[model samples]
Target chain A: MTRASISSPKPALVAAAAALSTICLALAPFVVREGDLRLMIEIFAVFTFAQSWNFLAGYVGLMSFGQQLFIGLGAYFVFLISGKAGINPFLLLPLSFVFCAAFAAVCAPFVFRLRDAYFAISIWVIAEVVRMFISQKDWLGSVSGLPLVATRGMDRTVVANTTFYFVAALALISVFGLYALSRSRMGLALAAVRDNEGSAAAVGINVWWTRFFGFVLGSGLAGIAGATYYMSVFHVEPGGAFDPNWMVIMLFIVIIGGVGTIEGPIIGTTIYFLFRAWFAGTGNLYLMLLGAAAVVTMLVAPKGIWGVLRSRLGFELFGTRRLGPTNHRSSP
Target chain B: MPPVLQADRLSRRFGQIVVADELSFSVDHGQCLGIIGPNGAGKTSVFNMLAGVIRAQSGHILLNGADVTTKAQHERTRLGIGRTYQVPQPFGQLTAFENVLTAASFGGGRRGQDAADHAASILDRTGLSKRSDMPAGALPLLDRKRLELARALALSPRLLLLDEIAGGLTEAEVNVLVDLIAAIKPTLAIVWIEHVTHAVSAVADNVVAINFGKKIAEGTPAAVMADAAVQEVYMGAVMDVAAVG
Candidate 1:
């Protein structure tokens, strides 16, 4: 009854690293410009969003392209309820998560019935449907969208500071949430399903139900990111609300970093930001560069940056808490 | 003891071909039943139907006298019906231990610590305790077969369905497997489809010969192998000398 134990340097070290990184980031406001800090907040939020997508696509093999549907819902719900309904935006953020998660749960049965490529396309279509529907709505600001007409509980300066703090908090939570999920039994189920659905069933795991749960949980995380983003931006238009570009950006982050690992998205997002800053003045060139980079990454380093680091140097920026390909090897 | 598995008038057809035509059989508790057939005999198809991988067009399968004809594959597994594929398809990304652990958790319905213990025990029983940390996909042919058996054992099945478990092994490997299976025979009923006659004869209490999906002969392994109809069915198909050796 002795289970095989792969070498792991305690979860405490990983937790410490996460805490240290968070503290360093929280104190970043003193040395950094407001613009750079804003970008960092955006990147952290976006990194979480991307990692959520990766959890479904990479680990569970859900391959959902309609994650923006929940993202837009997260952004729009917080905008409407807090900005227009005149509620304390920060307090209302959890509500957005509930709403978005509920929406994903309701839609899961229908969308999950479609297998592989069709499932991916169905999510995309659903997001577009939501976007088009919002574009035609009157109270929610049709094509032009709506702005936060009134500020509730705080002035502009305080709101900016609070919003940055909220973004940083949510990002940390996202990392922890992903860490917890990947380490748990659910994460093991997802990896099994991703590897072989038939074998998973033979082992008595309900593949469809596990995948649906992962999809919903991931969408809930995206919903949290969307809510925090809405508070900072203070606006929601249909075009901006359900941005297709956001999906591509998230996908890129995960692929560049490492698909199924926690640090993959973080590393990918950091590299993406550096590139984005360098190429911002070149207009469409940034998109082209990223596209080319993605193609090259897929061809050359299909495992991505974390994959390379792990294989070459036995590196783990985030603690090893989950079952993955690495867990299969017998070490000396 | 009551029959561990009973298939009542299981019938299925594919256009003009009847794969399982009113096939009825029962395996008693702690019995080992070996199924033999020439190529295209639908032996695997029968295992598939019993495991709930493929639904029978008509008829019912009862485990412990409870009908489970309409249950899903995972449901059947949860009900303690574990099976191994002929090709040995273990989860490629998982270590041999994890593969068995998943089976322990889901099929055996054990919780956290209990599941791990069950998985480790299953691995040990299958002679895979040493190679537990190796990825299933990376294991050698014999080890892969061991892992497949270990995975099924993890479910702690009341009835284990094995499809061609010894089809691709050396004679020495087959002997090793036969001994392993012999040791586990007292615990559960097993229905194994095999081309290797020695492995089947070594462990099975009963043998059934199938052709075109119907039972051609059924009795003790020696008696069934000696049946004229069974001989005609496997004539020139399998060398008798090679099987005995």
Candidate 2:
């Protein structure tokens, strides 16, 4: 039997790009202004959320429109624990993730019964149910919501810089985690499941288990982003926390950047931020423009910007494609 | 010594159409059972039941003495049953290597380097090694069928169920496939449902003929093909022309 070269190509390029981004983003708080730092924090939060959604919709073929369920739960979990239980806000991140994951596990069996369009709507309905329940809870301040009181005593600069660094770290972790997952054994099963569930089953992939993992992991990441965002903002409300617009924005980013590839979310989020900055004063018109852009991207480049570039230019930054000689003459 | 797969009293119907009526058969270890029928004879339904893709109204499916009637498709796969669809179903965006690797790792119970090596070998065996890096969606029909067989083989199944894999192949391509199946027959059992008579007869040890969900003839390939009942069912159906060609 002849051995094949299975190692990913361009390891150096991936490493260098990772290092450069880490260094530049790590020093942003010191070099960038406070207003810029705030924007950066928002970008990082959205990046994390978009990355999670991309993983679910792009990789696992579960197009959930109810990601707000986790975001709201994460922010609420932070509020309940830190505001009532007196835990530090920063320390509540893991608790928030656990809460969202457990919630997702409970929801999976019911939501999985619906497929394609119904599945997407069922998640939105579940999120609405959760939102209504939270709105009616008196201890959680009902519809008014609660403030993240734990950070009230911290120094302003310290809080801002720490939150900035935390968001940056979370963004990096989410990307790296998903990239690593796409290279693992479970990742291969997920790709198969995404492509064709019937064939995936023929190949011994437990479709339910693979989808459950994606749902839980995606929810947990969304929760983390929510918790971190609320921690920095110092406030949380059901309306803002569980807004359906979060799902729309995520879809836009993943679709515009390129679904199913690691670089897609990153590139999509960057372009989204640029568009947001340009239309900052346009209110709903900004959203309309984004929607139109998404439509155009889908029409012209159905695979998204990164997908077109990958095929046309052989430009792969994350090494998702298999690399080797296309001929049998070269033996490994 | 024992049969690798046994379907006892399997019966299913869709509304007024009976897909399988008291269908029963057994495939012994290393045996090749060819199921020949005209279109709509429910050959694919039988394959579906054995592979756990569909449920039979009242039947017992045993694999190596264990009752697996209620097992899900993936569980049956893990229990050593693998199947190919009548139409090839490759992971469209994934590379051919990735597609086979999924089967080797998940279905065959191999891991890491073992799965990669096994996938590479299967691709080589299927004459798909050069096209391994190409996306499965980009492959032509013949390569797609080859990928389907390669993916099934990666499962390392003791019992393989093939559904019309040779339907679209040319005679020369069918011969190549027959030779490949013949080469693998000594190691595991295969239950092939084919509209192509010559291809099935060349590889299968025994042939069973069915019409309207009921078995009409069973014996060696020659005897079954020559059975009057089998000939009558094929008279109006296109099987006569298929058999001749």
Candidate 3:
């Protein structure tokens, strides 16, 4: 057999892009204003959420409308551990993630039983049930919610900056982690499963387990984002934590940015925040505009904005290379 | 030696329509068995059962003498049963190389560089090396068929199941596929379900005919094709002129 070399065409460019983003985010604490830090945190939170959703819907073809389940669970976990148990709020991130992962694992067998639209709705129903259950729990302070009491004694600037850094790290991890995954064997399996489950099975991919993994990972990330959000805000409520609007915004970002590509979520989230900032005073009109924009993006470029730009420019910053001869030789 | 695959009294029904009834068949190691039947004759159903895509109400599917009737489709593939669909379904967003590489790694149980090497060879053999970088969904029909075959072959299976791979192909393209299959047949057992009689006749050592979920004829390709019951089943059916002539 002839030797074949498979290398990404623009590895340097991808590396430079990664380095640049890291540098900018790392220096954000010194350069960014306190108010702007809050906005940056919001961007990071939504970025992580969109990344999680994109992993599920884009790579696994598991369209979910109840990702808020994990987000809420993360917040509640932080509250239960830090707010009630008095653990340091910063140390609660891992606990929140693990709890959300366990919750997802338990939900998998039941949710996997449903397909497509039913699966989406079933997940939403599960989130609602969780919210309602949490609302009635007296230890969680009932529907009134709980505050991050652990952060009460800390300096306001120190708490805000630390939380800001955590959120930024999460955003980086979500993007780079997904990028690395999309280049792995498991990532190939994910794409296979997404494209055609029947064909994926025929090729020996465990379709159920692959989707389950995606579900768990996506949920865990969403949980972390949720925990960070509530930690920064110093409070968590069932209503705010489990809001379905989280999923709505995530879907809009993913759809407008690009559904299946790594670049989509970042681009989508950036566009989303820009629009939100520009229309901050418009209230409900802002949401309407976002919805309209998503509809227009879908109709105009179903692959999303990143997808459109990638196709038109013929460049992929994080695209995985095909594993075969790069030099195209004519067939025999 | 144990047969590569055996289906014992396999039966299935879709409400009122019986797709397979007591369908028993076996193919030895390095043998090529061709299955021919008219439309809705349960030919694809048998392939589905063998591939574990559909369950049989009552039957045993054995791979190398081990019962696999309870196995899931992916498990069946891992157990050395690789198959292609009638309508080829390749991963649309992935490049052809990625599609085959996925199977080579996951189905063939290779990893890392080994999987890449295996996938590369398969792509070259399938005449898709030049088109390996193209998204599979963009491939022309003939190339798509080749991709299906390449993906199935990536499993490095003990038994290969091909469904209508020669359909929607020019005579020359069919010939190319026939030669490809023939080249690889020496090392693997093959069960080919095809409406293209000439393609089947050219490559299959044995032929089986079925209609209404029952095996109507089985023997050497020439004998089965000439069987009276086989002719009767094909007569008045649209496939009759194409299959029998």
Write candidate 1's Cα lDDT for A52-163 as tens digits. Answer: 7988887778888778888889888887887666787777778888888899999998987898889988988999999999899897789898776545546776677777
Residue-by-residue lDDT tens digits, candidate 3, A72-102: 9998898788866778888988778888998
Cα-based lDDT at residue A253, candidate 3: 93
Per-candidate clash tally: 0, 0, 0
Isolated chain A TM-score, each model: 0.91, 0.95, 0.95
| Model 2, C-alpha of B99: deviation from truth (Å) | 0.8
Q: What are the DockQ scores of the candidates, in order? A: 0.50, 0.65, 0.72
Candidate 2: where is the Cα deviation over 4 Å? Answer: A323-332, B240-245
What is the docking quality class of candidate 3? medium
Q: lDDT (CA) for every model shown?
A: 0.82, 0.87, 0.88
- lDDT per residue for candidate 2 within A1-332, as digits (tens), equals 74654556666776787788899988888899998899889999999999988889998999988998889999999888888888887888888889899999999999899999999999899999988988999988789988978888989899899889888988987777777788778788888999999999999999999989988988898998988888888888898899999989999999999988898888999999999989999999999999999999999999999999988986677885543234333422
Q: Could you give the DockQ of candidate 1?
A: 0.50
Please give the distance, in angstroms, between residue A72's alpha carbon in candidate 1 and its true position after superposition.
1.1
Candidate 1 Cα errors over 4 Å, as ranges: A1-7, A25-33, A150-153, A319-332, B241-245
Ranking by lDDT: 3, 2, 1
Worst 10 residues of 3 chain A by lDDT: A323-332
TM-scores for candidates 1 onward, in order = 0.93, 0.96, 0.96
